[model samples]
Target: MESRRGQGSLEYLFMIAAALVIVLIVIRVLSGVSSNTPNQQVILYADPENFPTFNTSDNYFVYQTTVTKIGDDLYNVTFKAIAKRDLSHVKIRATLMCNKKPVYVGDQYLTVTDEVENLPKGWYISRYWSPIRRDEFPCEVVLYVWVG
Candidate 1:
């Protein structure tokens, strides 16, 4: 009877140890998933009220530039442009900067069908990968826009 009781207690100890190991494994997996998720923020140099209207003229106006993180190190950037005067063609150029360093640059050509009078035309940039560290979060993002 004494030997049986000792064996039963030993079994219970083994079961408890197994449960603790399973719990630890679960915690580690959850923490890994959370760490890989991207956290993002955008900073604008110009005033919000005057934004998307940084400059305007009888020819063209550039505005509404934004950068957003879509996934781990992935981003989606967009901006707006408006035509003030009739033109045969137009070109839009964008430069994305992080921590005062250029990370991406792109350009697009616009046709007459792409815009309307007094209406803003939208441009999008997708899947931009940024190589930055967690400590650099909420990093300053600057977008430079030009139309020609």
Candidate 2:
């Protein structure tokens, strides 16, 4: 009789522990669901307002410039370069400006053709600048393109 009573009490405690675990799991799942709603979206990048959306030059055109935050103090700048004329080599120097002051400058050198000849007109290339450490937003980009 004493052994039977002890066994029943053990079973009761096991059931209560199981119930507590299930309740915790349900609460955690429900909390996760609420946190993932559309209103809680995260901003992956910074879109500067004063930056030029489309910029043109004699030898090339720069457009679709984007600044993305990669780390706490590092940011990346990317832009599309379209060749206005045929060229063998293209060099792009992009300067990130904040409040009329230069924050970071990056250079991208692209070989458009294998041979030492012109790549062709209207060819496009994407340039991703090295990461910079600038936390300010609403910045601008100054482009300098060289073709050979």
Name the regions of candidate 2 deviating beyond 4 angstroms.
1-47, 50-52, 62-64, 67-76, 99-118, 129-135
User: What lDDT tens digits, residue by residue, belong to model 1 across residues 1-148?
Assistant: 3544345788999999999999999999998775443221223322222331233222344334444455665444344444444433333333343433323432221111132223334332222323332223333323332322
Global CA lDDT computed for model 2 = 0.51
Model 2: number of backbone collisions: 0
Q: Rate the local accuracy (lDDT) of all candidates.
A: 0.38, 0.51
lDDT of 1 at 119: 33
Off by over 4 Å in 1: 1-59, 72-74, 100-148
lDDT string for model 2 (51-127, tens) is 42435444244345667667776666666656566767555454554432334542222112112235567766665
In lDDT terms, which candidate is top? 2
| Count of residue pairs whose backbone atoms collide, per candidate | 2, 0
Clash list (residue pairs), candidate 1: 52-63, 52-64
